[model samples]
Target: MPQPTPLPAAWPALPTELDGVAVTPADRARYPYLSSSYMRVGTPDLILMARDVDDAAAAVGYAAGLRAAVGQVPFSVRSGGHGISGASTNDGGVVLDLSALNRVEVLGADLVRVQAGAIWGDVAAELSGHGLVITSGNMGDTGVGGLATAGGIGYFVRAHGLTLDLIRRATIVTADGAVHVVDAEHEPDLFWALRGGGTQAGVVVDLDLEARRIGEDDVVVIHQASQQIVDDLPGYVHAWGDLMRGAPREFTSFLMLQRLPDGRHLSVARNVWADTDIAAAQPAVSDFARLAPLVQHDASLMPYSGIVPTPRSPKVGQQHIQMRDALVDVADRALGERVAEALRHDVASLVELRSLGGIVADLPAPATAFGHRHQEVLVSLWAQPRGIAAIDRAWEPVEAVASGVYSAYTSDTRARQAELAWPGETGRRLRAISERVDPALLFDAGLTLRASAE
Candidate 1:
């Protein structure tokens, strides 16, 4: 009898019969769970859990072949497994699990190379020794590949631009079954689309990211339990947006109103930055506190990684029903109040507004696939409204003052979801590029513009 490879301390021993890739029903008993999105439930016919870049390429080849045989097939790749949209998994397709390839290596003091499957929390610990930081999602458990390609918005948001902005290079497995290393100069078109459009072109195996040097001692967090949006929900965005614009680039804030487990809703505000001299930074922090009716405010120096909430393991298969309206807007006060009122009365969910602009808007919209660069605030509403009627009412005010929407926040497979995510000229650009790079259409275009948007 041959022996199976000893499992990692965290994972169970793999069945000897199961190699790197596992098929359904065969591996189903031990490894049925895979993905973190709540929008859909699917049992993939094939699950290519790769052990390395070579394995990932082989999996991509298999999916490409299957997709080629049957037109418009569903195939997906999951990394940190925290994809908010249901695109992480498919009804009956392949899921290329990249977690096994997790590796983090510092190229030097200021650049880091990360495998696609690794989570940011692991990367943070790896980079902490170098006194370096990279802008990523607010959650430490976020996957590097998904967030990086989808345009990461994080604690260091206003301080640096989007995460994709710092990408130095990447190794992606194209449909031709070969790993192509791309950067600004190499395969620049594919690289440009990958910056914010996601895996429509290929599966990124690993990436080189530019790291900003900052130590644990330089990080600071400003927390305040200020006015509840409930008091003046309509007045929230304009006040917060005005504050975000006037505040120093060193500071970033998130305005949220969420329901507690006790069924009470409280508005919350949080600010983070990495800097020396708290006293020098005090006056600017005070400006944000006075924006709404102040309740409490505190400042403390912490680690760069400390800005993200403590990493929590996601519960697989435990789907939370949520409808999100993620938009970019200047946030008209009167319109914001209407949105707030709608949220307060109809939805039992939370609403979040993150500060945008600063370096994020400095680049031209054509610089990357992310086009809503002009907007100063991100309005995200997570709710389960009564029905189409209630949802329509809740979205009206938000859409009124918004420039455009982000596909990541909403997972519904609408007929024109692509059109909504990237509208007009931007959508046309993505469509044309997608056709050029992904002639097979094997890659999922859920996050891009609709192809038939004539």
Candidate 2:
């Protein structure tokens, strides 16, 4: 039998509470599965699978102790293991895995208790039976902790606002290992920070969300449209944006635009009607179909759960692409031209534009940590990870026109990115709270406000 990898000499000992769930490299059976996230591969020195809130607290305390004794340690807090920023895993550090703490409980007609480790798809499925829906990301496999803590731009964002907006209460373990139950009434500062401040505030174990009533049975109309643009990509993009912005709150859409190798452009839109009213949704759906030259169009009224079904897949960092995003107030011709120009650089593989307005815009900017409520569109640039410089150059212009940044969609976690995600007053408040709660900056993974604060 092979011996387990020995712990580093300078590292602090693991807490006894975490011994049963800890996986070192020598535990080859479980180590591989827990070592990587959706966008990046990692070889963590220790993976602590927290069984409960107490275990989660213990993990934080252990990591904090290590940081105090040995200086900066790469500590990551992972929920579902599917993090686009790739901050959930790290090389030669500690990963506090909360996958085992997943639980979805319906406490009331509109209130639901969801563990951090629960996937958005599973939460949607559980709520579907009760005719309740919570707006989440496009992927069902995304962890609730990551999305709810960040900003959730989903198909119903125009109708329901962000996932963070629905957070009624949360249980978190801060850097000091103190378990805090925060809500609008209690620990208001931490509650404000927890909603959209990422993991910098602490490791959230679970959240109680106020789910929205979708209808009689969580049913909605899903329209998928495809267009082939042979010329003038900017014109078509602008038209699609116009239609989406003018559409009613009941409608939301996501557009993926890419240039094919044959010198043509492929524009696909996934449109969602927040209700089962087919007649009311057809007009906007029709407008989307006519954007370029429609090649395919499909619309069906189905349960919202069907749109975000949970698929069990292991995370091996299969998605190794470089991603950058910007939030803009309008998708006018100028923005469209900028997107086209970026693609022409041959560095970006594609660009995604997600509609965000309607009810989302109704929220006051200071309502939460995600203060870019007025931005109507989120533009994301994707590349093959050829070189950071090339992609950065390609995305520079687009970022110049953007009003804000969505941390979840971005891969760059540097201080620059942090400055964009939490800019000005928001950055100042989050920095103050972080300093008070985590003075040593032990929980400094993802977009670090501490670095930006400096």
Candidate 3:
């Protein structure tokens, strides 16, 4: 494989000052540490922390001019730095960090504008005060920039749809350094692309999202654990899937596997239902509780904000972490056995099965860059760094059992994973859009761009 050329060191045509821009070694060090996701291996050549959108635009313009002059274009703008593929960092190029541009303004009780640098936690907190909330990622630390653009999924997804569904408008800085406001009425094509397009299109400075008022006090969250893997696991999954198929719009669930302190394994299932009839939703989740004695159950009504707890960062010292994902319609008994068998090999290995139906599957393909609109469930397999050989040995059995990959859960560098996520025509369309917006192929480093284009 050929190595990518490094970006130039000096800028000949850049202005002396860029609207209160700051570029120091400390700033560069901070940029390297800006990644929020688990993958943190690269460092940017230069860091330009912009104070505002003008400053951001100016910084981008300077980088573009320098790229044209030195025949080396930069990768992309990074906000919240959650890209799992390391797209936020460049080998020897400028990284336009938007973290400093965090700002939020409520247009009214029903709408607000958020800077790309802000995380979903801050947004939710600010909106909750006004009795309004926007659909956002389940993880509070996830940035609104990447999540909204990549089709935000969360606890509220069963009701309000993806995060992009709430977006009313956005201010984007195009590759040509021109700033444009996009919405359903204006620049509709660009708006369509931005919904689920990822960061390949451009840098979104600000996003205007529609907000809704729900019964925050009516939220019900339940967490239960299964002690043993029984033959009834598949039956429980099928029953849950059937319930979800007919579930009210206000209910959502996440089923995960966690390692117990005694070196034993347990399956933890969490369900959040906001309907008026809590007793009715209980029967849907009762089988799992029956399968194993309840470990900890919190089924009482609480505030909507209370349901979304603070997200914990990835554990340290776990290098060489590899994740595999799949979307399945039915959880087979044989597959469950294989998963249990794989878990016996290592302590850190986990199988996270998230129920996906209702609003998630009803959305149109072009609604956002999220292509898996028809997937019923998303299964993610993750392994920590025991060693490269250990990861290979543990992941092989799980990989063999999975049917397909989920785009969001899989790493961005895996092109094969993207192919499994998007399949044929959908993958081609996303690639074509990437080429059109980024003709010079500047944003191709860490993202799952077309391998042939590279």
Against the reference, the lDDT scores of all candidates come to 0.69, 0.85, 0.63
Error of 1 at 140 (Å): 1.2
- Tell me the lDDT of model 1 at 168: 86
Question: How big is the RMSD of model 3?
Answer: 5.3
Best by lDDT: 2
Runs in model 3 deviating more than 4 A are 1-14, 26-38, 71-76, 216-236, 259-264, 275-280, 285-288, 311-320, 332-338, 341-348, 386-405, 451-454
Model 1, residue 214: distance off in Å is 1.4
Better of 1 and 2 by TM-score: 2
Q: How many backbone clashes does candidate 2 have?
A: 0
Cα TM-score per model: 0.87, 0.96, 0.83
Q: Write the per-residue lDDT of candidate 3 for residues 1-454, one digit (tens) a residue.
A: 5322322455553464552454434544443354223455544555677787777778777777777777765545767666554456555567787877668788976788999988777777777667677777566666777778776667777777778878899998776677889898997767776776666667788899987665442333332323443344445455556666666766676777655546455667666664446576676556445654555655665555665554645412123556666766555555555566556667346777676677777876546556667666676667775654675565565566554555545543566565665556556676777787667665555545464221
* Model 2 residue 116 lDDT score: 97
TM-score of structure candidate 1:
0.87
